[model samples]
Target: MFGFGIYDALIIAGFLGLQFFLSARNSAYWGAIIPVLFISWLTWLLVSGEIKSILAYLLILSIGFIVLLLEWSEGRKALRNRREKELAKMRSYDMN
Candidate 1:
């Protein structure tokens, strides 16, 4: 089904868990839980082999992609900010 196997499910769960961990401070807890649940539900829908099931899976996947993209952008920005702070601290130490 869509080339997804048990490994894919595990990977999806792991990725969602990691995203949740990274963004827990920035997002509502349910926001992360919802995606992880949707991922599982989508997997089941894909395996059901019905037209409506397929559509449902597609919608879930689309939402998941959007969330992941948002998380990625936020992570990049946070990392950049952290690096800038570290650099500024180092410069101040050097000046002294």
Candidate 2:
């Protein structure tokens, strides 16, 4: 369908990228992505005038939220792993 054209496809990719960048715990890039994303959505709304289509975009945001959760848990796991590694190293050093 025309609704899912090349432009829409690109926007979908960008939405996912934005989610990853945001969930990466990196704030430096948000300044670049936030305005662009907001304006893109605004322009798309004005041009499309299809309220029903917003649900699809919102679904992308939902996916972004899920990504954020995953990233947070991953960060916790990594931190725990690092601590365990440090403890192992300390114990080996004491044995030596």
Q: Which structure among the candidates has the greatest lDDT?
A: 1
**Taking the tens digit of each residue's C-alpha lDDT, what string does model 2 give over 1-96?**
135789978986676555545534434343345445555765586458744466656665566556545554554455567678999999999999
Count of backbone clashes, every candidate in sequence: 0, 0
Output candidate 1 Cα RMSD: 9.2
- In angstroms, the error of model 1 at 18 is 3.5
Tens digits of per-residue lDDT, candidate 1, 7-92, equal: 99998778765665565445445346545766776776677754256566777689877977577556556666777899999999
Q: State the displacement of the C-alpha of residue 78, model 2, in Å, after optimal TM-score superposition.
A: 1.2
Candidate 2 wrong stretches, greater than 4 Å:
1-54
Model 1 accuracy (lDDT, Cα): 0.67
TM-score list, all predictions? 0.54, 0.44
